[model samples]
Target: MNKRIQILSFLFLGLSQIVFSQIKEEKLILDKKREPEVKKIEKKKTSVETIKNYPPEEKSANPVTYDITNVPAVSDFKTSTIQGQDISPNFNTDYQNNYVRFGMGNFGKILGDAHISTVLESKMEVGADVHYLSTTGLKKEYDWNSNQSNATIGAFLNNYGEKGKLNLEANYGLQDYNYYGIYALQPTSDTDLKQKTNRFTINGNYDFYSNEILNDVRLQTSFLSDHFSANENQGAITVNLSKHRLFAGNDFKMNTDLGVKLETLKTDFALLNQNKSSFFNAALLPEISFYKGESYLKIGANINFLNSRNESLILPQDKKSEIIWSPNVEVLFAPQDEFRFYAGVDGGLKLNSYAELLTENPFLVSDIELRPTNTKYHLYIGLKGDIDENLKYDFSAGYSKINDMQFFQANSIFDDVYTLNRSAYNFANTYSTIYDNGNLSEVKGSLQFFPLQNLDLSAELLFQKYQLDNLDEVFNKPLLQATLGAKYSMLNEKLNFGFKGIFVSDRTTNSFEISPNNISVPTAYVSTENRNKKVGGYADLNLSAEYKINKNFSIFALGNNLLNVNYQTFNGYKVIGAQITGGVKISF
Candidate 1:
């Protein structure tokens, strides 16, 4: 009788599990070493106006959240059954599947953005992002345009026996960029300085997971292909196998990762002369982590070897192979949930991949140099926490000694006369990537505050100092940068408005063209023969408003550089002033 009862219970429970999951299941995945944090009034690290991916857009990266979520899975299983919150939450009602937007503004600009995303029955996500934007110069009538279309498909494959669950992703993208000349040298007619890029990427991971607090292992592989219109192409592939094992009580863990990276770059600037480079890399990372009440510590080391074939730039001894080693250490002290202190020391080699540079600034010269930046040492410290449950802040300072730091500077535009300060650009209307060894000291801070009901505010600031080995100044780097932002909701949360103001301190750079061979600009302090690299500070203000007509529809308008201040971020790339756009968004 006892055996029969046990068998019955097992059968009943198994059937119940299948029925409940088939009804509706949404598994929140946190295995990315991050927590699934839910909150209202989340911080906006960057202005939406910066998402256009155009010349006038901002390029700064968003601040880190500093929320430590790497922890072992909870083991306690509650006996009393309580279902999750049903019907979703009220705040999530505004979500949608498809989004469409259209806008027009000065400079003969007409822009449209559309996104279509859907989830399949097999737990696969398929999405496409398409946008079109064209702008004619308001000052010189030169036209600068861009078009971006990308598609992504991702899925998690289960049903395979215990070896692991497979996660896969595939992506394809096409983008176009144009180079309009400097304000100092406007083209008599529209020029044909443009580049088109096509990209394809595939990534996969097989994670070994179970309910126990034991060791975890995963295998990851990825491939990338980039083809440019100017006959430049790059192909890269990477594979990594990583493992994380719990050492003791949920508080200590050991981790290790081993990876292989391969890359090839081909450049055909001249039909008769083609340059090709291939690199092979092997990397190993091992770390130990300790986490307990109010304290967390981590120690790690990175070892790498790079094998370059047919490379003439390397020294004779290092021509065939190069080895690099770096140490990593991090510590955190959190006496309470609202306050924490953290510091870290690390270093590594940053592979200057072709694809990464193309995206950072597309107006690059055709014949570019590829030099990986070797970060010899990096030290950072920070304090982050919440204040009164309404304001959160982070402050960090870092210093780094680097080799082969790449800087974008104005290319010489004249061939007849050559000087270190200015020379003829090998390619027209494009910037050149210059490498220099340097030491950088930087301090950055961010804050988010909710001062009153329905009102939110945030601010960020960055300060930097550069000491170069050969150069007097670091090109295109500002000493200080800051942003102030505010957002408010009204009409019972039906209408939302946001405003952001940005400031960039004066920066000194080298390389620029003179109106003629040589010219002079008189300044308060002195008279210089040229002002090509002398750029002044500027302020930018932007405003945006959105009116939600219904749950799935909304109307929005945005004004960028509302102050109408014309400023040059690069030596000759002057940003537009006072542009407005409006569009309606619909979700399905």
Candidate 2:
């Protein structure tokens, strides 16, 4: 019995020692965690790896809808320079094999569009499209006869092979408009106010899918003419090649681009007689790019040759030839995954084609001169990043020096005999292109927010300032611009709503100088009196809604200029007032 008691006592003492040791170890661990040194280390590493590996957010599935009516609102000008192509409305619709839509609104406005595509084989496809829009005269009192219409037809083919892809497209368009800016002056009749334009274009491209050298080739041709006997033809070809090699213990991509462009213009004026001009341009661009970790750098240069010839009997005889060299450099640095910084310096030559000018202002003088714009240098810096999974932001600033920058002014300033004898567009209703050396500074910012899975909101702002060498103001260029848009999807993605708003600050332009003697007469008499005019600021609001009835059919309604402000895009051309249209969409 005594031996059993001793064994039990020994087992109890061992158990007590094990329990005490465990408690002491746990207390030590808690005390260490409370220390300032340990707390700092824990905070530094919290979620660091998780954020570095976070995946990019998925893109929105719902498509953005566009305005059905083709209103020439001043809000359309988003920047100092107008860019992008005037594509048919059919190409802007939702992705479908076959689509059709039609709508109508006030001021005798009409919209019609259709697109058809079919797959002939596993690697071949063909498609065609047609678009039309028109509107009658504005308010009756204006007596402007501001009739306008646009029609276009296009066809395309695509072929895909194992190693390359080929694409071909052709398009023809007709535009009819009236020079109704006669409100600024007195007119006896609207006899010579109508204008018609015709354009044809063809484009072809081939892209190689390979790990080797050659990349792609492209060719384009276009012809444009108007009822006033003005015609233009243009053509261009481009080739791209690239290779990857190891240089200085780093992998680098060397790229080369070769291009050539030709343009010919012919114009017939009753007073100035016939004029013909030709322009030729050639360019070679070479670039090298290298990447290390999260940093990327590109160094490049552009070498160009420009030539122009004027073969005219009545107009001034002139010729020009020159060679231009410009530098190109770009850098991108990303210290972490959430932020990126980019900087670049670039420049190029911009051909001032008749078609391009007409797209900006339809009422252009037939005898206006053509010149090429050269950008000496452009320096820019930008930052882009994400605030969180639901918000993204981009901000940028830039400065540029430009030679032969184009501006528009009243034709009455010409003060030639043609102004007195011309039958149409002779008054202050027409515009002519002028050039000057200038410097531009700009700042821009944008934000995109997706608070919910089916909701999207965006806002953008731009500010621009210009300094001209000779000109008084940046003609018809806005100083400040803003755009806001929102989209929502609901009801199992069957119903959608969209809203858009545009705002622009005051724009300055040259106007007919008022007579110092207070005598009201034709502006042609006082041609030397040049004065500045301010076009008032304006805002445009648009709303759209769509409801799907089934898989193949949907109904939509669009409202434009909801604020009912009749603002002028040009000096005297005013757009239509508030208008609404409803249409049906079909897809097959």
Candidate 3:
């Protein structure tokens, strides 16, 4: 046919130029998506005139800062409010063998407390305590190893005002003691059988109060320092005033106080460089008290004056003056709420002078010893009662009289050497020394019973008497003591058991002679004898137990001389028969 219609008219003219090149590649991908939406609508109309001619750097989102040097500096930082007032240290140690009865002792304890506070106010506190003790053997010629040490430090100040109040206190202390000696003369010699003692102390206090005076009054001041190695270094100063009142009988009330005290003492022993002494004391005391309903009354008096000086040239370097009188009275009687009654009386007077300085550049004097100035009296009575709710009773009695009483008589060519002016007069025993007079008396009683309610029962009694003017040749008899005890608590109270017993009696007198020629010659040509002995009454029993397995744990068991009887209560000292110990404790 016409060449197949001219090849279908060039295949419809190449499909009309391929449909116009597929509509120009779909309008060039719709003009690249409308040319980025027509350049984002011409960049939103040219950013609306540069955001309407610029004005908006106000973009804080909250910020005000100083670089702080690029912030990052913490070299070991620690804080818990500065470690909660920092001060934590404590250690303790204790060991025992054959425990109580003051034997076989070993202990060490340490403690500390510190405080400081402030954010806007003030406060400071400091504290310390340390102690050590030891005893292991020997106790007659000494040698039982004894040691003691003590230390204390304190400081306090507080002020956080509103009205008015102030307090400041300071304290310091040190104590040391050592003793060891056990005869045989030199059993591993500790040269001259060592003995040492030391002590030092300081104290201060100040107090003041004011309600603008009259409606409130209080004032105080105090200072004290004491040091003793053997005998003295003391000082004191005190002053106080107080007043409180409500008088027109609203059950009557009155309280008053007045005081003054000044004291000084310095005895320089400093290793026996030879005796030295000094003293100055001044005192005034006034007190009054009265309270109603349950009754109370008190009165006090003390007047003192003393100026003394002694610097032995072997005794007399006199500068002595003295006047001392003390008086006191107190009474309290409770009419109900479990009965009570008390009574008291005290009296005193003392005057002194003694001069005897031994050896130093041909200096010797002994006869200025007029020390028979005296007055001392004491009488006291007491009673306490409770009868119904679990029984209790107490009774006491005392009587004392000492008038020019001082005794010492020993001089038979130094009765075995050991003298430090035993009331000097040794122109080679100018008719052997003599002085005698004495008195002392006492009585005590107690009884308590719970009977049940965790049971506890107690009984105690003591009586003492000593009166000598030649107690048949020099005293040693008259002291009776008794004690009985019981206690029990079972398991619910976490177990606790106790028992105690004590009873004693003694009587002794001795005088002996039988010498061939140890010459002190003639006691009617020797052969003198007088001896009496009755020392056979002693009993002691003690048992203790405690256990609490909770609340920081606990366990304690002790038995002392529980029947292992074998006695000797001083003559050569020997007592320590039975022993048992158990211990465990934890606390926090």
Best of the candidates, lDDT: 2
Q: Which pairs clash inside model 3?
A: 137-144, 143-181, 314-356, 314-357, 314-358, 315-356, 315-357
Cα deviation of 152, candidate 2, in Å? 1.6
lDDT of 3 by residue, 225-298 (tens): 12223344566666666564534265656666666777666554422124556667676767776767656687
- Worst lDDT run of 10 residues, candidate 3, spans 38-47
Clashing residue pairs in candidate 1 (N, C-alpha, C atoms within 3 angstroms): 412-423, 412-424, 412-425, 413-425, 414-424
- Note the clash tally of each candidate: 5, 0, 7
Q: What CA RMSD would candidate 2 show?
A: 18.9
lDDT of each: 0.54, 0.64, 0.42
| Structural similarity to truth (TM-score) of each candidate | 0.71, 0.78, 0.23
lDDT of 1 by residue, 487-514 (tens): 6555666776666667889887665433
Residues 341-417 of candidate 2: C-alpha lDDT, one tens digit per residue: 88999988877887878888888876676777888889999987664455667788999999998888766534433
- Measured over all alpha carbons after superposition, the RMSD of each candidate to the real structure, in angstroms, is 16.8, 18.9, 39.6
